[model samples]
Target: MGDDHSAARPLRADARRNRERVLQIAQEALASDGLTISFDEIARRAGFGVGTVYRHFPTKEALFEAVLLGRIERFVADARALATAEDAGRAFFGWFARVVEQAAANQALCDMLDGGSQAGPQVGLRPGSTLADDFGAALGRLLARAQRAGAVRADLTGRDVHDLLRGCLTAERRSLARGGAVRMAEVFCDGMRARTY
Candidate 1:
């Protein structure tokens, strides 16, 4: 019988590097150019051929999904690192800002992932292992800690906090820029803190 390991297609070291480069470039393109960036431009910038790019990511939607998912994983890992903040409120605000920024970028990703767009199906995505869930869990942990410390109100669930931030991100994109977004997040955080009894 053939070895189980050999049955799998092992990515050569160069292929692995190229794949990672494609993901990084895709993120830059999405951040700078939004969802409609050209896959051909991405391939040229990454020093990989069009075929190589397609080999790593089959379509434009797939490339965007990979970029979004990759950023989410990194965002989650970063949020977990904030579990040791000096002030619970600061910690909460810190991650709240992170979520807002990511969501601003992910609005396009959500359109594709949630069936709100015409982007074709993407491969390799599992049911629940998305950046959205990862960030949501991290935010939940932070919010719970903050509420327990009386830094946030008890009436607000993590879902409420997330939805609130999503609204802020979406709104800021249409009419405001980065400074407006920072102030908006601070205002929301202040409102979430419980007043002394």
Candidate 2:
């Protein structure tokens, strides 16, 4: 068997710039079009050929995994920042609401876990794997902080957030399919709020 030598690359600043631009453009395209965004569009917007995208990310799922990791990191960072928010419950609920909104807009992100795990070059991105783990790790830090601050409920786990987002995304997809987004967010947000004892 021949040894794989393709992993070696002398990092260059200019190359890094191009890759960053590609990531930014790809992120926007995915945000706007969800899973429907094509690699061709991402390449066009980034002023690069599909080859550049493939070079940076061999598969669409790899590129998607990167974008999602960014979202998860930023989301948790924001939650950490809000740990001392004026109202603890409000902080938790508001952060949850932000997540719900993202899921509402990008229902395809829900399939991210399952899709990444399917039979494809992108299967490396399984939700219980790297990309999802990145989100989970970030969430672990935030959840501990939020719980200590009495922001979120004590019994909730990070997986709960993932599960809840999945449900919300499913509901949002059905609602949009029916041309209705009315009170859906309200009901979801209400459910996130803690009960008054």
Candidate 3:
């Protein structure tokens, strides 16, 4: 039984690698072509058999949710890293800009993360998922630190930060010209800064 288990380990590792590759390809395809891109296309791009893709993701919705969750998780990690920066204000604003840039590049992902009523069902993210909570906590920490440092307004909350980021999404959706979103982000950062008489 031990030998059998040991032998199966390699198969499991290979399966994990295949799943990761499929997800990577799916993200790129979905970002470039939207959800209409076929699973066969994703499989071809991943260099995996269609069966392998189905074996891992069963449905397009599942694959999409996986991709969305993976992206959110990475963003959460980035937020956490930014939380440790010496310049709290710079870290928060920098992360905000990065998120906006990402949203500009991948509008669908922005919609999913924004968790608007229209996007919840499509992305399979219910309210208060662990991923959402983690992201919120990270943002909360950053906001609190910036506020404490007197770099940002004390009245601002995590929800406010989220709303501002959503504004960036709106700008992107409107096809705001290049650098427009960054300028909007800068305006938001300026608004959030603590005022001195």
Candidate 4:
């Protein structure tokens, strides 16, 4: 039984490395070329055979899901890191701006997060998933901290913050190549701040 369990263990080191490499290349391709980027192109860019790509992600949808999930996980981690920042307001606004900038730079990633992909079903993410919960929790903590510090309005909720970020994306689409989203984020942050006068 011990030998059988060992044989059925997780991927070998090389295989794990290959999988990670493939995912990285897939993210780049998706960011630059959108969802239309083929698996063959990803394999080519990664310097791996098409078969290897297939071994890692059996279908195109699976690859898309993996890339989207990885991005969300990273965003959640960033939010968590900001939760302990010395200046709650700066951390909240800075992270908010960074997320908007990332969305502007990578439309594909933004679309995936918004569930605009036809491959949504394949991604298997649902409303109550742990990923969503963790992301929400992190954002909630940041917003609460900012509010308690009197850096942000007490009336705002996490949903309001999300809507504000979505507005940034809309601005980005209208002014592609000009980075309007980042500017919009700055203005939004200013409005969210408490006004003493």
Top TM-score hit: 3
Model 1: per-residue lDDT, tens digit, 1-197? 46765655465766888899999898888777776778799989888789999998877877787777666576678778877676877788888776665656555543433333334455223336555577678878888888888888989997798668756666656535544534566666777889997
Count clashing pairs, candidate 1: 0
| lDDT for predicted candidate 2 compared with the true structure | 0.67
Instruction: Using lDDT, give the best candidate's number.
Output: 3
Writing each residue's lDDT as its tens digit, candidate 4 over 31-84 gives 889878998999999999999999989999888778878888888899999998
Clashes per candidate (backbone, < 3 Å): 0, 0, 0, 0
lDDT of every model, 2 decimals: 0.71, 0.67, 0.82, 0.81
Instruction: Give the poorly placed runs of model 1, Cα more than 4 Å off.
Output: 1-11, 102-131, 175-182
Task: Report the alpha-carbon TM-score of model 4 versus the true structure.
Answer: 0.86
lDDT of 2 by residue, 74-162 (tens): 76677777766666666666776676667556544455633443324443335566545766665566566666666556777878866
lDDT (Cα, 0-100) at 62 in candidate 3? 87
**Per-prediction TM-score:** 0.78, 0.70, 0.89, 0.86
Which 10-residue span in candidate 1 carries the lowest summed lDDT? 110-119
Ranking by lDDT: 3, 4, 1, 2
**On a 0 to 100 scale, what is the lDDT of residue 182 in model 4?**
49
Looking at candidate 4, what is the lDDT of residue 121? Answer: 59
Supply the TM-score for candidate 1: 0.78
C-alpha RMSD of candidate 1: 4.7
